[model samples]
Target: MKRVLTEAELKDLLQAQPEWKLQEGKLIREWTFSNFLGSMAFVNRVATIAEEAGHHPDIEIHYNHVVLALISHDAGGITRRDAAMAAKISTELASHTSPKHE
Candidate 1:
């Protein structure tokens, strides 16, 4: 099983990933787009990234808003893998042509 991160480690992770937050045992991030189509496009890209990483996040979509929460179920908490996945997602978003938020 994957190793869960310690509180200290999680703190460091949060510092490195300022866009994400720790909430209810999950690492989460949210984004807002200009329209529903933009939101769906972002979600689709996330789907591909999740598949490639094999770490799917719980997703919530509300029109132009989207939220993703990731946790390592096997490890029973946040893990290094989760942090890495978050970094990948951030990197992907960084390359997007349009600003992620409205």
Candidate 2:
């Protein structure tokens, strides 16, 4: 059975996912894009990843900002899986924002 992340575990995870932070007792992260389409595209990509991981997040998307909150209902709190998924999402977001060289 999956287990909830302890304070120590959550701290360690946070060390790796510096871009993510705890907000209102939830693991939260936000990303901003240039336009609505860009935000939608990022949300779609995040949805795909969430589906593949079997872990869904609470998301709030606006014209250029997307906020994600992760928690495990079964575990009744945050878990390592949530942290891992957050890390993956952060990496993808970073790659998406990075300038590409031809």
Candidate 3:
């Protein structure tokens, strides 16, 4: 089973992925788009990413805003796998229209 990230590792994750926040034992990030279509487009990208990595994140869609939380439930908290997935998602989105972070 995957282990929870160490304090140092968590710090590194936060540093590397500044947009992501360590909240309630999960890595969370939120984005706001110009419209609902824009939000859905971003969500589709995330879906493909999560499927490829086999790391599904809890997704919340509220019109043009979206929130994603990554956690390794089996590990009982965030792990290296979650961090890696976060990086992947960020990289994928970087090539597209810039995400409006909140």
Candidate 4:
């Protein structure tokens, strides 16, 4: 079973991931895309990453925005797994292309 992160550890992790925020005990990040296609593409990549990691996040999709929320439900809080997943998602985000304005 994974262990929940202590407050100190969480703080360090958050510092390293400026785009992510801790809210209501979950690690959350939001991405803005130029259109629905861009947003869906990001979501698809996230789905694959989450499947490989075996740590799925709660994802919310709007027309041009996607929000990812990660928490270890079994651990009842954030864990190293969540941090790792967030990092992977961030890495994917860096390589993703924004939708072109037509």
Q: Per-prediction RMSD in angstroms? A: 2.2, 4.5, 1.2, 3.9
Give the per-residue Cα lDDT of candidate 4 at 96.
89
User: Which candidate gets the maximum lDDT versus the true structure?
Assistant: 3
Choose 2 or 3, whichever is better by lDDT: 3
Off by over 4 Å in 1: 97-102
TM-score-superior candidate, 3 or 4: 3
Error of 4 at 10 (Å): 0.7
The ten-residue window of minimal lDDT in model 4 covers 93-102
Model 4 lDDT on a 0 to 1 scale: 0.87
lDDT of each: 0.88, 0.82, 0.89, 0.87
Q: Which candidate order results from sorting by lDDT in descending order?
A: 3, 1, 4, 2
Choose the strongest candidate by TM-score: 3
> In candidate 1, what are the lDDT values of residues 1-102, reduced to their tens digit?
999999999999999988888999999888878889988999999999999988899999999888989899999999999999999999987765243432
Tens-place lDDT per residue, model 4, 1-102, is 789999999999989988789999999888789889989988998889889888899999999988889999999999999999988888876778442221
The collision pairs in model 2 are: none
TM-score for each prediction? 0.92, 0.88, 0.93, 0.91
Give the per-residue lDDT of model 2 (tens digit) for 1-102. Answer: 689888898888888877788877789887778889988888898889999889999999878888889988788889888888888887776777522221
Residues 1-102, candidate 3: write the lDDT tens digits: 999999899999999999899888899998888889998999998999899888899999999989999999999999889999999998889766456666
Clashing pairs in 3: none
